[model samples]
Target: MAWNLDSQRPIYAQIIERVQYDIVSGHYNPGDKLPSVRELACEASVNPNTMQKALSELEQSGLVYSQRTTGRFITKDTSCIRKIREELAKQQVLEMIRRMKQLGFTKEETLTLMDKIYEEATYEHTIGV
Candidate 1:
């Protein structure tokens, strides 16, 4: 999880976003145990307190749950995971659309790009590329 701390957002917020991305991308699947706070802090080269804050936010959002003695685990709700995935997908698509608009891409050009991307994705899957 290489993070760009230079972004305008706070470090903890970036950490939270990265973790959420991991969850949505299936890197941390439902019910999977996450690294300990200290471990994750070291891995991310961030302060333990920052990592804890990020984890706390995730727990509050119900994306992760803690066991009294076991540790934090990714939520076991498939629907929650799907919802997160959809929400993130929508956000990314919106951002791309906004950028394309700013760059003077017409609606037709945007649709053409989308179709090209879809075709490439399908072709890659079919050819195992």
Candidate 2:
């Protein structure tokens, strides 16, 4: 999953985003120890230095922490994780609204479309889509 990177953006930034998503989404739970930098680099097919930079950035952001002679672990702060989750959701919503406006849809129309889509999606999920 970490290998799904693109050339349009910085690889380390992408790695940070992926790791953050993993943490917030519960793929890596609170206090879970992370794999070694070399291991993550191997998994992402990136240079170890790139993975280190990403992890360091995440550490500075308080999402990850390290102990002496021990590996990095996900932060145990559920509130911080929740805040990050909301921030990510808001980013997606903002981008969706931006695209809708670009397509000439007003706020009301966008909301209506969203409602319809949500209903259809809910129905599909109920039916085991």
Candidate 3:
């Protein structure tokens, strides 16, 4: 995970978002064991306690779970992961629209431009660009 902390939010919350993005983007697979708290702390350059707090929140969100005498793993619930992925995608799209509106684009213009860009990207992907 590329950890970047912003002044706008808590470090642990940023950590949680990074982990969630990793899981949804397949950087971390379902049932995969995450790095130890100390390891993740080193990776994110934060204190161990902060990483632990972020992991605890992930557990509460059903994105991860810890086993006795073992360690934490990404949840095996594919449905939950899929739901989260869709939610994040929608958030991205809405943000894009919001920015375009602030730049004076109408709703139809924003969506049409989005569709055109997606089609071009899809074509490139299909051709192994």
How many clashes (backbone N, Cα, C below 3 Å) per candidate? 0, 0, 0
Q: Give lDDT per model, in order.
A: 0.89, 0.92, 0.90
* Ten-residue region with minimum lDDT total, candidate 1: 1-10
Sorted on lDDT, highest at the top, how do the candidates line up? 2, 3, 1
Of the pair 1 and 2, which is ahead by TM-score? Answer: 2
Error of 1 at 122 (Å): 5.2
- What is the lDDT for 102 in model 1? 100
lDDT of 3 at 20: 87
Rank all candidate structures by their TM-score, best first, as comma-separated numbers. 2, 3, 1
Q: Model 2, range 1-129, lDDT digits (tens) per residue? A: 558999899999999989989998789999999999999999999999999999999999999999879999999999989988998899999999999999999999999998898889888885444
Q: Each candidate: RMSD to true structure?
A: 2.7, 1.9, 2.5
Residue pair clashes in candidate 3: none
Write candidate 3's Cα lDDT for 5-122 as tens digits. Answer: 8868899998988898999999999999999999999988888998999999999999999998799999999999998899889989888888998999998898788789878988
Candidate 1 lDDT over 10-116, as tens digits, reads 88888888899999887998999999999999898888999999999999989999998889999999898888889889999999999999999998999999899
Residue 93 miss distance in model 1 (angstroms): 0.4
lDDT of 1 at 4: 57
Whose lDDT is higher: candidate 1's or candidate 2's? 2
